[model samples]
Target chain A: MLERTKKSFLTALWILIITFPLMGLKTVFTGEQAEVGIRADAFYLAGVVFLCGMMWSMKGLIGRGIAFAVPPAKSCTGAIKTSVMKVPVWCWQVGILAMLCAFPFMGSEAELNKYFSFLIETLIYVSLALGLNIMVGMVGLLVLGYAAFFGIGAYTYAILSLNFHVPFWPSLFIGGAIAGVIGILLGIPSIRLRGDYLAIVTLGFGEIVRFVLKNEAAVTGGEQGLPNQHIPGAIAAPSLGFMVLDREIHYYYIAIVIMVLVVFVVHRLNNSRTGRAWIAIREDETAAMSMGINTFRMKILAFAISAFIAGFVGVFYAARMNFVNPEAFRFEYSVLILSMVILGGMGSVPGVILGAVILQVIPWLMRDMMPNLLREYFPSAANVAGTLTDFRLLIFGGIMVIMMIFRPQGIIGNARRKIELGVEEERD
Target chain B: MFQHIVDGTTQGAIYALIALGYTLVYGILGMINFAHGEVYMIGAYIGIISLAVFTATGMTLISLPLCVFVAFLAALFFCAAYGYTIEKTAYRPLRQAHILAPLISAIGMSTFLQNYVMLAHGKDKFDFPGIFRAAFINNTVQISGARVNYLEIFIIAASLVTMLCLHLMIRYTRIGKAMRATAQDKKMAGLVGININRVIPFTFIVGSALAAIAGVMVSMYVGATKFDDGYMAGMKAFTAAVLGGIGNITGTMLGGFILGLAESMGIWLISSDYKDAYSFILLLIVLIVRPRGLLGEQVSDRA
Candidate 1:
């Protein structure tokens, strides 16, 4: 124990020295003067580093104890597959739907906006993740700039609504259609390239889309984006025939409905012949072509369909937020969405939703929601509550690296994909 | 046109410097080192921060050249260390994993590095000490017919020397031969007694060291550096690597120049507002026409 403690101290000291220039000294600009301030958080960092080193040293001892609590993915997936079901799958799905429908009522009347908005946003992401899953999971196309389509769908609706006074209902279909058309156009020349090359092309395309949106000041309002913040009530809330969706609860119903429709469409497509052809192309394009699969055509179809689904959420998100900005459509946002798809195990519907929820909620909880809740409920532990807020993204990055290192197949990844990703070679 | 050529060549040199790193890593691993751009960005930070620290400690007062030299050395050393550590921690374990694993992990690492700098350095752009600019600020040289600033000329000359040194090192050195052997066939190279582990980390170290040169130079030239600047520059360098043929060293250098020239000429012809679009358009056209880039490629079909 003493030896481990000594080693931990050495590791922490090393970390401090290595990171001294960057983390220890901080540059703070006040007015016109620049000053370097020593960050007091160095001690905290050293403590954390020491703990990690000790944890590393005692891995064998801890592993046995932790193994029983958290099962390996192989066994976890097997448990899901072989476990006895008390009720039918459809009944459970219906139960979930009913629960979702009753979400607004579950929350207090005053907090309807707060609670429903959260659910609404979650549902929107669920839809987006499912849409991205079409191309990434089923079709096997890696799109680095899927957010461009989302931005397009959003900007299309926002522009049409604010300028032409077009209703949200009609703009939904129009935006999705426009996005799908753009997808087909994008996929035409680029789809012929191999997977890795295609990744860069898509990345470039995404950058081009963002740059164009930023550059075209007149159309996109440049960096500030559409719907000027200074001018309130310029853009109205989305409306049904009865009334405008002026509250979060109203938007919640629409989001859940749209999400279900997306899930159904995606589920149907995944089991369809077209989906199989796309998978064939992904697995081995040459073989797929030899089998007369019309690989290029199938690839294009996947792009269009996936882009279409992402487009729907883009419209809903813009309408719900009553704002559209180029900032929302950055490469980082695309990375976040791609993380969702990859985290969920690419082609699995439930996996994608679970991945979306975990990535979304965990970060959200760390950044503001959970911390605030903790401060409100437990005043004594306030110091430790939001301490993780600043490092949420750093923690997130570390998690991604660790997750990929240990389980590249992802949590509840597709069985075949799990094997393909080499997660099963450990033979748990 | 003459002035634009000088500007293009200077800018292209920087891109080429960064692109060499990308192509070299891709040659070895057949995976895109997504955090490479971050390494370059971090290089710039290290350079500037070191200068600030030196200036604060009265080292610059003692000897300005010595301080600058020390600063450059610090930047190169730290960046190379970062590259080696990143590869060891995030990537080395996933050597046999699927392509997506390493790619996503690199992206995550890139994000972490960017945010780490952002948190430490603050999100605001910081000014470089203008060590190089002092010599080239007002000095202009007649190149062909155009009056080119010494800084631009210096950038071009520095880039050429760096590339030449890299070429010589790779061509003549034992480590270079080992690297080439590993790139061609890892199994064979291992059979022939080359340590794959040593070669991979060495490749990252060398690439990162080259990126440090570009980072310091660009920070010196631009006068300011931001945390997120790497993403775009990195993308363009990756584009350059692909345009030249991804794994080919000579081709990447040529690709960087072509892209730089194309962007400069495009900006001169069109509006500067659409500066970023020119590279993408050029990339699209080249990809449509050549498929394998200008010099062709030697990417292994394994992972």
Candidate 2:
């Protein structure tokens, strides 16, 4: 009764807030010469608000229902505790709202587009990190060939969409499926290995994939890469009563939506039976196998799922960047992703997100900010200094070392996760 | 094709030297000692610096023994210090922790050492002076329509001498016997009044010096040395060590030659860019098929 009323109230409040922004956007764009579709913004906002409302209501219901069903004294303390919290929900809401609000603040149209493009790129990394976290964090599988899946995804989209003229949406799924299959194939051999051996094998796999991509020039276009990929018609135009897909903000919304979907699915999977199986295998494979769990199957599943996510992101990257090249997928990228997973906290989702954002944005931000900041203060230093990118690899390597020495558990490692990582395990 | 084999053998000899360091440490310590590669890099840089100083004073034609003596001393001291410090600071703490922790630290040390050199010296490839670049003998042995450079002979000879010395040290010396005992069982060695600590450092010093000599030889052959050169060469050498049954000295040497030959043949058959890929692919296949490596004992008792 009270919960129902509260949910209704929240939903109404969300709708009203979204409508207010929609109205503001409509009026602002009315006088502009750009063929901006105010309706699309309204629709997107409504969808976002509705999704938030649903998640909020679901959490409320789950919490109260669990409390009602499981008597406080009788129920296990941990079981009764709510996993869904308001903090992450609010963070997501506030972040998205802030980004959406910035749409109207751009002084010029070009700046607005650039901002949108940046958001799309951020989304790609977010998706990739989430996918990688599945293998490295959740499963405790140290896959050095993570970028191979990304390549698989990219190549799948490139070959299918470019050669077969498949629509972007369908090809995206196909790419993910193809990469997932490849991941499983790789994971099969990986089941027999552990630790360093596993790392070496995956590293080899990554090289093999890269080599094949380079050698199969007839199909992959070799070093030149596939260019001028076509974006799907649905997203290409302002259709389905939505605004045209012209602005960077629209692409940003698309990326955000995809990231949200990936995050939601991964979060759910992390708490599922399959997720528990992965954890069990990671903890002790021999013991896990003794317990009737097929360790090989579970590992393969984790790999496939991770690869699928990478594939999904790859499709978006191809569409967003409108370019695909082997240079973008390199061992360095694999190392970068691995660093993100390590630095952020191996098993923590939020930590992976934090790592991704820092790794992706810091270098670019440093590149832009350092030169001007340094120039204004010390004019002579500017003349002798090279670009920040020049020292980026060195800085990154230094950080990896420092982090390993001081905080191998990563920045936001969970206590239980730390223990499982062998912090508490006694050695002979 | 014959010339390629000769070149491969020459390169393989250098890899064999570096692989000896990896194999020696792994044999004694049961640790990867990832910093071993950086020791090679540092040794090369030190050799170049020492040689440059010597050549500036017109001692370009110094006696071979004197040159080897100075280079060996520098390599021995610097590498020993590096190896000891790495063990004490990075590894000793994590000895009881998860295996991954030390491995990560090793990677960190490798990166730190590489970058330390890069920053100290500008991020550019430094050329080794031409003092040792001259061929000791100018004649080429023609075999099956191919010319084999006589420099190959010197590399093979030098590597053989080093290997023979190492073999003698391990088999005949008291320190060598202590090392073997420690490798077999650290606790037992300690109980038997062997200074395990002393033996470990000695192992490191010997291993690192070998790597250093290999580094100088490689830089000489390649004509230039980059601060980041250790990554590729080190990886290849490490692969050789793994291929040769990790903890076995003779196996490591054999592994180096095999890997070198494979890489050379791969370059001949395909593109040079694919040389690394081929070696790594071979490593992957070998690891999957035989985790124990060639000539390695089946230690199926481990959990």
Residue-wise lDDT of candidate 2 within A83-185, one digit each (tens)? 4343466677578657655764666766566456655776688788888888888888777778888888887777776667676677778889998999888
User: Model 1: per-residue lDDT, tens digit, A213-263?
Assistant: 998888988888888664654555677778777676778888988999998
Highest lDDT against the true fold, candidate: 1
- Candidate with top TM-score is 1
All candidates: CA RMSD in angstroms? 3.5, 17.8
**For every candidate, how close is chain A to the native chain A in TM-score?**
0.87, 0.71
Q: Which residue runs of candidate 1 sit more than 4 Å off their true CA positions?
A: A1-14, A26-47, A63-88, A229-236, A378-387, A416-428, B130-132, B298-303
TM-score of 2: 0.77
**RMSD over all Cα atoms, model 2:** 17.8
Could you say which candidate leads in DockQ? 1
- Write candidate 1's Cα lDDT for B214-290 as tens digits: 99889988988999989889999999999998989999999999999999999999978889889988988898887
